[model samples]
Each structure stands twice: as structure tokens, then as C-alpha cells.
Target: MSFLGLAHCSLPPQAESLRQEVREFLAGALAGRGAAARAQSWDGFDPEFSRSIGARGWIGMTWPRRYGGAERSALERYVVIEEMLAAGAPVSAHWFGDRQTGPLLLRYGTEAQRVSILPAIARGELFFCIGMSEPDAGSDVAAIRSRARRVPGGWELSGAKVWTTNAHRAHSMLGLFRTAPEAAERHAGLSQFLVDMRSPGVSVRPITDMAGREHFNEVRLDQVFVPDSALVGTEGDGWAQVMAELAYERSGPERYLSGVQLLLELVRAAGPAAGERARVAVGRAVASMVTLRQMSLAIAGMLEAGANPAQEAAIVKDLGTAFEQSLPEVVHELLGVEPDRAADTDLGRVHAVLLELAPCFSLRGGTREVLRGIIARGLGLR
Candidate 1:
């Protein structure tokens, strides 16, 4: 009946109210806000939308008050995100920073670093991206060769980060680099730094995805100077820090929301109560979504309890990506409308974009192979 001894979860009473509030906010706030684009989420950057969310105290909804955060419950934050993704808002501008980097910084960053960075992030004034993946090291995060040499007041970094989402427009990036030469242990001798996007030695080149969206980029770091205060946590402890951060990144509503809009559209097309086959398909899809969302929420509870469920998070991400990527095919079966843009111009745009973007779902956060390997090792099967 159970796999990992993890208990089933139910949302608290507050969660339902928060979800309703977010729904109303999105209904009036995001309606008719922007229509030229079609679900350009994740990498769909929008500063105005981010600022509006920040003004409503939703950016860092669950962080400390000193950093301009509302300090609400994690469940509340999850509800807000659920509503945002449902409304197809362009939250990619402040998504990475708010979701992973800011929280990580609040936990591990030094006093000066937090004082300077956290408030701006909470206000949605400063956007950030992660510099993890390199040219050859896709899933092997430990194989990164970005070098950061010790200098007078800080470190001098030199290297590049590939597939960096929003790097071209970000205000800063938290890049993992080698402080010392590579050691026998891949996790050793590595460090992380806050690299300013406006620094003299930095360069950002946009990489358009197959969907024709200029949302990804290659960020080059050439002798970029970062002050010693920019370091988060201990120097050699970055490998551990990054692993902990991935626990936050990999376990979230975003993993499942990638194709949810398409699913809802399909359901709309199928009518109130479709035939037996269509009804079964829709029920199966919704059940899968509900199950996955429960797993993600459980991880959030664990995080609130100050526990790290890294293996569990990796599992959710891998399975969730597989689940999200299946909506298009199932929709095609239940509804005869294909992804052909010209087939139905009324809503073909949404279907076409979802199909164009489905392949990348398994690639982002972490590849499916890497996630499965992590799960295998956790179960002592590797």
C-alpha cells in the first residue's frame, strides 16, 4: 500500500481560503493583462506581473518580516503559485529567484548578503538565475569547471553557464564555481558566488528555444569580480548547499503545472460529462495530478519541519515530468483536435505551443535519467 513509509497528506483549512483569495486575485488582476503571448511561463519573463505579485506580498510570502517578507505558511505560498500557474501568468521573471535562490540565501547567506539582496528579491525588483549546467555536464552538476580564484577583496570568476533561463535579463546569478582545483571527490573544492549581471566582465547571449521564445541564454563569466561577502555559507560546503537547494527546486507545483492548462482546455472541449472512455481518461489524469500534488505538498511540510527530503524530491520531479508530458497525447486521443496550428485557429495557438514545449519538460530542473539514478541509489538499488 506504501512505497517509502511516507504518510498521506491533507491541506489545512487555511490552505483552502488562500487558494480562493489567489483565484480572485488572478481573475481580476491577470485577466486581459496580456494576450499576445500564449503561456510563456517559466521563461516567460514579465516585470510588471512580478511587481504586482510583490506588491501584494506574495513574492516571499513565507519568509521573515525583516527581509520584507510576509512570513506566511508554506501552504499559503503553494496556493498562490497554484493559482498563478492556473491563470497562465508570466511569472518567470522572479520565479527562479523567489522559488530557489532567495530561500536558499535566507537560509545560508551571510548577514550582509541577506541585508543587501533579500529585500530587493522580496520586492520583485531584482531577478536572479542559477548558473549550474555547463556545456558538457548536463546532469552531472559536480563536473562544472567554472573557476573562481581567490583575490584581494574577494574572488575572480571565469567560465560560462549554458541553458541558463532568463540570464539575459536577470539582475544577478548565483553561480557555482571551482574555488580550488578539481579533486578526486567531485563534490569537493567547489564554491558558489553571487555574480552581478552588470559587472564589467559579464556577458549574456540569448538562446531561443524551439518555440521561438528568447527565454534561455548562455551567460559568460570572464574574470568577474565578486566581493567576499557575496559567498553564501562556507566555501567548500557549496556542494551540500546546492543539493539542499535542489530539494526545494525539484519539489514544487511548477513540476506539474507545465501541461495543466492544456489538460483543462481538453476537459472543456470534452463537455460536462463526456463518453465513458473520455471520462475515464480525464479522471485518470486528474487523479494523477492530485496524487503528485500531494507528494509535493508533503515535501513542503518536511521542509517546514527543517528536514531535507532530497531523494523524495528527485523522485517527484522525474515522475511529475513524465506525467506532465503525457497530457498532449491523451488530449489528442480524447479530443480529435491535433497540434496543427492551422487546424483550429481559435485555440490552436495554445495546443501548438504546449506541443512545441513538451520535450523540454524532462530536460529542465534535472534530466529524467539523473533523477531516476538518484532514486535508485536512495533505495540501495544502484
Candidate 2:
């Protein structure tokens, strides 16, 4: 409960060694890809690349061995992910499954669910998307209208989810649905279900972003039937479950590293002859990344120790996203290069795409205002 007590964190000796291995792997795997490709970062989807990483037993590095995991520590997994992001590896194909869904399944899913799904995720043969936000819900989890009604052997789910990343390509979704009528407690009556995207009556339609990319999707469920085995954890416990999952989603390197290529591009564009302002700006950006990394690492350490660091995760996400969103603007000002989407240079392509995508960094994980509220409530300030 002490917000002032920042947990001390340092990579273990094994983690230090593992970093070199990951870097070497990235070098060979990412050979011809330039900064523009790296700028896509975790959002870049390459199933073949994901399968290659999985072949190395890097996908489920921290899960239990029985579930096809490597049984490594979270710190080890942290090093792998940091290296992947830093090198701008195309990790999106298996990123969500590795980052949160697999962990959540291990924690709250049935044993049968774990045995069936975790191994595929580790093998990079299956992908998962979260089903939290609805057309009406956005960040307000309590406002979701997607509901499930009992139907003998299982339940019938009917409603839609928006902003579902990779839904078109995902094999399954950990969907949140209302199981009962709204009660006096708004967070009550919510439930989580393991939805098979390929099931009858389920549909996925891509939603193109301003950048003309189709990473997000609108998933519609019209009386989709799921067996009882699909229910996750106890009934009406999804609110708590979703909150825990957010900690995993929001505290990672992706929160801050979205615009890393832009910073690198800035340095490349403003060579040694650049003015003092450019140097100072680059230094300041680097410092911010360092600070956020420390905070995120602290949270990762806590998670490794079986501790709930939701509050700390919120703090990292809020500040990390602010840093990410502002980086492109800072780069534009300091480098003074007009971003051209059609430009032949790596920096130009990266700059143009980042300028369009930067605004989403804050909106994607959790809005700045929502995250700040979570942090305040955790610190007893609300």
C-alpha cells in the first residue's frame, strides 16, 4: 500500500547471459528489416517469426513445464521481451497469447483448458484476443452489455466487442460477458468465457485504422453457444479477473517502446553536427525510457514473486504511454524533418507512421485519465 516504496529490481545473472542469446537471435532473425519495419514493433505480425521464436522455447518462458512452458523465471521472460521490443522483432502473432492470456488461463482457467490451450500458445499455433471492451463499454468495464444466458448444457452469448486486436487472426478470445442482471454493485454479475472464434454464429470484421492498417476488429456474437467447459474461474468474477489481466497488458515494454524507433531515427537524422537542442531532447527522451523501464521492471519482479502489483502497473502505464505519445512530436521538433509516408528513407517512413499512430498509445492500454484514477485510488488519494 506504500506508493513511495519502489521495489528494488535488477536482472538476475542468468538474465544477463540470456540477453546476449536473445540479441544474437534477433540479429539473425531481423537481418534485412530496417527501422521502418522495426517501428511496427510489437504490432508487427509475422506468424513464421513467431513460430521460430516458439521453436526456441521462448513463448511461454515463465509458465509451468507441464504446459509446454520453459519453466523460466519472469525476469528471464522480461529479458526476452525487452530484447524483442528493442530489436523491433515482429512479435504480434503470439504476443497477446504469451503476455496475458496464457498466464490468465493458468491462473483462472480450468485444468482442461490449460492442458488444451497453453501448449498451442507455447507452440505459437494459436492466438488469443481479449474481449473486454464493447461498443458501449470502452474503458468502463461495468458498462459492457455483452451478455450470456444459461442454455441447458452451456450458455448463449449475444453482443459485440470493438477494438479487439487481431480478432480476425486469433483462434480464441477470453471474452467478458454479463451473466446476470445489474445489481446494486455495478461490478457484480460479470463473467468471463473462453470463446472459440471459429464457432458458429461468431463473426469478425476488420476495422482499419487511420494508418490504413487492419489490426483491430469488430467481433459480433449472435447467440453463440459455448459449452460449460468454456467458463473461466467462478461465475461473476470477471471484473476482478479483467483487472488482474490489465496489469499484465499495461506494464510491459510495449507501453513505452512503441516510439523507440522514432527516437533512434531522430539520432540518426541529427548526426554529430546537430544543434544542442536536438542533443538535449534525445538525452531527455533516453532518460525517460530508463526511468520507465526501472518502474516496469520493479512491477515484473513483484509479479515473479507472486505479488499483485496492479497499482504500480497503472503508474508505469500512465507515465510510459505519455512518454511514448510525446516522443514523435519531440522528434519532429528537434529534427525538423517533415514526415513523408511515401519517402524512400527508413526515418521518413517511420516518422510518418508514428505520427499517425502515436495518439493511440495512450488510448490503447488504458486512457491516461483512467490510469491516473486507478493510481490515485491505490494511493488512497481518491
Candidate 3:
């Protein structure tokens, strides 16, 4: 089989109807939400709005009905995400739980854990944050020093996690820690635990970004006790599990749609009488978006078929982040206008924020160098 096996994907006819439904809902729901709020894109956090989306049964659309899922196809869920990001809807409150964490729990969590957590996540009443990156270990999951020493009926976790998105607001975290000392082989002795964020000794401090947003956090686990039941999958299996979870992370529409609001505003700012240069730039960005969307949809299809296309996902994520990072610069160049915060307009405010936010786009998920290395390994070039 070819290494870059990107299969064809066509959404079912029902996806169009779902798209229209989401569009209508957004039209009414986001009428005056403003571009500054919309500029946050998928990172926007609104628990009330998330609960509203859950009430619509849009969360966990692909899981079993026994767990509060809609039992819908992954493609159906794909359409909802695409529409939401394109409309700049606030989905951050439930995005991580719905997009990846919930699926991870479904695949690995115990029956009791599922019964207690899955329904609330599906209802958008609960939120989760990833506990992957640490201060000393950004992309290198193997370099993490967080340890969970075995104790009676539980483990005492002690270490800190950095760049933990929404950790301050999350109810729980899927924390990757060392269950045993590092082996000669780098990937051994790793484990993942579902940690309750509100537990004693678990502290979350907000980390402000360049954009002045407090979404990311420093999560400190100072000898926090986690029951053995919170262990996800098997002990010493976290390395493999994290790789699988990242496949879900890297293959979503959110990877590419981060700058879509800026792109939309750019077009509106340009209007119909745009010069040839502006037209060409817009056309190029549109082409990239279409191609990336198709590739992402193909990955979604692979996931639906229970395939682990981690390499392909890395390729898609690398390309998607490139596009996302470049979009703001492209818009700025095309519009030939400075990011104006004082302007009484949505477009200006959006442009201002996106310029500040775009630099971090490639850093999230994984860095370009790390993603490229993953792709190279996938192709057996390393």
C-alpha cells in the first residue's frame, strides 16, 4: 500500500441538511456575538452555549447511544465541526471533551468511569483538558518527569504540566505520567490517568498568552492521589495511547479553520471590486482550504473505519497549521491595512486579534519540526 494513502471521501447527502440546520442556528444564536468573540474561533469558551449545543445532541455524535451519544456517523460529526468553525461559534468549552477526550475515555476508561463521565461530557455539562505538554517536555512526551508512585488503592502524582489548555476551567484531565522509572527504551513505563482537577493537591494557574487570553494553564499535581480506577487503558501503555489520541487531535477541521474568520473578514474587506492581486490571494487561500478539507475528511473516514492513520494525520496537521499560520499574514498583505483596535467594526477587531493569535497556531498540537519528523518516520525516510 502507498504510504500517503489518502482515500476519496464524499459526505453523505444528509450532511447538507445538517449543515443548513447549523447555519440557521448560528444565524440566530450568533447575531450580535461580535467579531472579537468570534475571533476566538473554536477557542471561545461559553458553557451556556456548549450546553445549548449538547441539548441539540451535537456532542459525542459518533459514540454508542448507551453513553448519551447520538450514534451518528463520524462524517455527520465532521460536518457539524466544519460548520461551527466556519461560523466562528464558541465551542472551546466542550471541544476537547467532545472531539478527543470523550473518545479516548470510551476506548480506554473503565465501565464505571464511562458511566460517570461520558454522559456529562455528551451533555456538555463536563469539560476536559489535555495534560500532555510540560515545561521541560513540549513535544517530547518521553521527557516528562511527572511520576505517580503506587500507593494503597491509588497513586500519588507529583509533577507539573504546562501549556495545558483550559486546565483552569476543566473538570478533569487525562494526565500522562511515569508509573515507573524510565527504561533503557524511551517509551516504557509511561501511563495515563484521568485526574479530577478539583481534587486536593491539584492546582491550576492561568497562563496569559501574547494575546492577553488566559486559556492555557500551568497544572500542578503535588502528590495528588488518583485511584487505580482512573487509569486509562493499561499500565505502561500511555505512549501508544497518546500517539493514538493525537491522531484524533491532528485530523480535525479545527486544525485548519483557525484563521477562517480572518479569511472571511479579508474577503468582506476586499469586496467585489478587488484588484487582481487581492483576487489571486483570496483564490489561493480558498484552494488551500478546499484541499485541506478534503484531506481532513478522508482522515475522518479512516477513523470511522477503525484505522490508525497517524502518519497521514501528521501530514494533514502539518499542512493545516502552515495554512492557518500564513492566513493572517496573507490577509494583512492583501488588505494593506494595519490591525486597528480602535476602529468601530468587527473586521478590524478580528484582524487585530488574529494577528496576535496567529503566531501560536503552529505551536499548538505539535510544532512544525516535530510533525515533519513524524511524517518522515511514517514514510520510512528516517
Listed in order, each prediction's TM-score against the native is: 0.95, 0.97, 0.97
* Decreasing lDDT order of the candidates: 2, 3, 1
- Residue 286 in candidate 2 has what lDDT? 87
Off by over 4 Å in 2: none
Tens-digit lDDT track for model 2 on 1-382? Answer: 6866459799999999999999999999999997888998767888899888998899998989999999999999999998999889999989999998999999998899999999999998898898988888997879999999999999999999999999998889999999999989999999999999999999999999998999999999999999999999889998999888888998787888888888888788888997899889988998999999999899888888888887888888888888988887886776577789988877788889889988888888788889989888987888
Q: Candidate 1 or 2, higher lDDT?
A: 2
After superposing candidate 1 on the true structure, give the runs of residues whose Cα lies further than 4 Å from its correct spot.
1-5, 33-38, 335-338, 342-347
Q: What's model 3's overall lDDT?
A: 0.88
User: What is candidate 3's CA lDDT for residue 70?
Assistant: 93
Give the Å shift of residue 19 in candidate 2.
0.8
Worst 10 residues of 1 by lDDT: 33-42
lDDT of 1: 0.82
- Name the top lDDT candidate: 2
- Answer with 1 or 3, whichever has the higher lDDT: 3
Question: Which lDDT value does model 2 have at 296?
Answer: 88
- What C-alpha lDDT, on a 0 to 100 scale, does residue 291 get in candidate 1? 89
